[model samples]
Target: GAGVSQSPSNKVTEKGKDVELRCDPISGHTALYWYRQSLGQGLEFLIYFQGNSAPDKSGLPSDRFSAERTGGSVSTLTIQRTQQEDSAVYLCASRTSGSGGYTFGSGTRLTVV
Candidate 1:
């Protein structure tokens, strides 16, 4: 793909259910990031993967949230025991190493009801 791609553009899940969001970055991007945007809130960094280095999980909100990048191209973000507060637009972005610009996906809108 020429740009970042995300799956399940919109997801409606019952409270306590689990959900997974997928992201496929550009062919050669080396840096991938996950962010969350709540209504009326700014983007919150969730996780970051750079090349083969250990992922930076410091931004994950809780133990229920986890993510991994496979083969350094595709990534998945899983949310367990979903809650209403978890409803948000999950965004994925990618950029080449040392690049200041990023290409972002349309995002997966998760609504927990």
Candidate 2:
């Protein structure tokens, strides 16, 4: 794809259910990032994956959130035991190792009810 691609533009899950969001970054991009944005809040970093090194999961909100990048191209963010507070727009971005800017996906709008 010419740009980052995220699946299921919108998702509605029950309070206790789990959901998986997918992201496919541009070819050759070495860095991928996941972020969350609450209604009027700024973007909150979630996780980052660069090349083959260990992923930086420091920004994840809780133990229930996890992500992985397979083959350094496709990534998945999984949220367990979804709660109403989890409702937000989850975004994915990718860039080359030395790029100063990132290309972002449209994002997955998760609504926990």
Candidate 3:
């Protein structure tokens, strides 16, 4: 992809439902990350992956949140049993090997009703 891409710029779901978001990173980049930001809030790191290294999933709010990257390119973030408080923007970022900054996607605006 020419730039990082995220699917479904907006999502509205009822409480307790599940939603899945997608991200396609820039070609040849080796580092990926996911973060969350509530309306009027700051970005919060959720997870990160760098090649074969152990994924840093420390910031996931709960076990119901999970993600996976395939072939070091595309990634998916899945949320289970959504709650109203979960409404927020889910952002994805990627950077080339040894890069100092990340390129972010437009993000998926998830709204849990």
Clash count in backbone of candidate 3? 0
Model 2, C-alpha of 86: deviation from truth (Å): 0.6
Q: Residue 65's C-alpha lDDT in candidate 3?
A: 95
Tell how far residue 9 is off in model 3, in angstroms: 0.6
Candidate lDDT scores, in order, read 0.97, 0.97, 0.94
Taking every candidate in turn, the Cα RMSD to the unseen true structure, in Å, is 0.6, 0.6, 0.8
Q: Write the per-residue lDDT of candidate 1 for residues 13-107, one digit (tens) a residue.
A: 99999999999999999999999999989999999999999999999999999999999999999999999999999999999999599899999
Model 2 steric clash total: 0
Per residue, candidate 2 scores C-alpha lDDT tens digits across 1-113 of 99999998999999999999999999999999999999999999999999999999999999999999999899999999999999999999999998599999999999999
Candidate 2 weakest lDDT stretch, 10 residues: 94-103
lDDT of 3: 0.94
Tens digits of lDDT, candidate 3, 1-113: 78999999999999999999999999998999999999999999999989878889999999999999988789999999999988999999999889598999999999987
Positional deviation of residue 104's Cα in model 1 after best superposition, in angstroms:
0.4
> How many clashes show up per model?
0, 0, 0
Alpha-carbon error at 45 in model 2, in Å? 0.3
